[model samples]
Target: MPIVLYHFPLSPPCRTALCTAKALGLDVTIKIVNLLAKEHLNEDYVKMNPEHTIPSLDDNGLIIWHSHAIATYLVSKYGKDDSLYPVDPAKRVVVDQRLYFDATTLFPRLRATTFPLMFLGKTDVEPDKKAAIYEALGILEKYLEPTGWVAGDHVTVADIACAVTTATLQAMGVVLDAYPKIREWLERCNSTIPHFEEANKEALKDVAELIKSKVTHNVYAP
Candidate 1:
């Protein structure tokens, strides 16, 4: 049986899993979990993923959720080589660090600033949240100072993970002009990463539209 991936296209984490699967040439059946409709909160999905997050993978009987874990497992079990996620201790530590950075720092900052606007009909970002996002971006800029990719010279799963969030922010009108290295690295990843457009760009359009639709309606509108 082909792996079943429960996902919503506009989600950056979902795109991370999709991009990793494509890079590893794994056959996956995508089942869209519509967050707008709260399908992910349904009992069946909750049973499969207690956390009820999108991009959970069911490979035969085994199940794995969390985008980074899914990506690492796919690379470890199915990759022809460890190039995307090196097995070497020194190299793998760096990759792990980048993944944690995406999950804990970068993505959370983006979510904090945007989720209220996207989901709660907020019209503006708070000063602190905006500062948090820029602080995270600055750290990413420093990380990319030494190499073109987030983890290193080569495009790893870390690049896929971080770039999806970066692209999402870009779609949401966050400027990258100040972070020239990040801009350049994102350009490189877009050009070289397999299925980059399919996995990220089209879905990002949907995210932009969703956010616009939500925020356009004022809470006090008649």
Candidate 2:
């Protein structure tokens, strides 16, 4: 059976899974879920993804909702080789760490910063929220300094996952001068990753414009 993906173009998680599938050369039927219209809360979509998040993949009968999991599944089942997700246990562990870093550390900050501006009508990013995002960027910089990639020397699923998060944060007006390694790594990802622009650029611009309409101040500004 063919894969069917439930996606929102502006969502980082959706872009992550979409880019992963593209890199693996997998054909997927895209179904747009309009968050503004609450389409993700519909009965069937929620049945497929209990959390009701974007980028749920229905691979035949198996359902994967989370982007990291979707990426892993696509690579394991269809990839010609395991480069995107290494077969070696030691190597896989590093990729796992970076994935969680994106999920637990990186993604939450995006939600925290955006939720208020988008949903609660907050005009400025709270100081703590702004600081939290920079802190994650600092941690990512430390990770990238050694190998120029988040997980290992090669671009793995880890980089794909983090790239969308980092790029989205940048488009939302996060300053990068303090995190030079991340800036350089993002450039490298743009150059190397297949379908990077197709998955991220236009969606990122949309996110930035949406947020710009709400936020009166750039939190990272002095």
Candidate 3:
């Protein structure tokens, strides 16, 4: 049986997994779990993924959720070599750090601002939330300063993991102009990744439209 992925297209976490799988040339059966319809709350899906999160992977009988973990696993188990996720401890540490940064710092900050607007029709992001998003972006800028990629020279699962979230923030109209390094790195990721448009662009457009329809004011300034 083909590997199965349960995902919601507009979700960055879901897109991250999709992009990683595509990068590794892994064939997956895509099953859309519409969050708006609460399909993830179904009994069967809940049993497989108690967290009921998007982008859950069912590899044979094994199950996994969380984009970063899934991304790394795909590269580790399926990738012909350790290029996307190097086996060397010193090199892998940088990738691991960036992945952790995305999970703990970047995605949470972006979600804080966009989630209320997208799901609850909030018109504006709270001052603190907006500030937090920029703060996270600032940190990302520094991370990118030393190397072209988030995790060093080569494009790793770290870039795939963080780029999807960064792309979603851009779709939400976050001003990335202030973070020149991030903007450049995002451009590089978008261009270099195969099937980048199919993996991320279209869903990013959906997220942009959803945000535009619900929110009247711009949350990102400067």
Best-performing candidate as measured by lDDT:
2
Whole-model lDDT, model 2: 0.90
lDDT of 3 by residue, 1-222 (tens): 899999899888998898989988889999999998989999999999999888899999999999999999999999989988999999999999999999999999988877787677789888888888889989889888887788878889898888899888888888998899998988898889877667887888898888878866666765
* Model 3 TM: 0.96
Local error of candidate 3 at residue 36 (angstroms): 1.6
lDDT of 2 by residue, 112-136 (tens): 9788888787888878888888888
Ordered from best to worst lDDT, the candidate numbers read 2, 3, 1
Q: Tell me which residue pairs clash in candidate 2.
A: none
Number of the candidate with higher TM-score, 1 or 3: 3
Q: Across residues 64-118, which tens digit of lDDT does each residue of candidate 1 receive?
A: 9999999999999999999999999999999999999999998998888676876
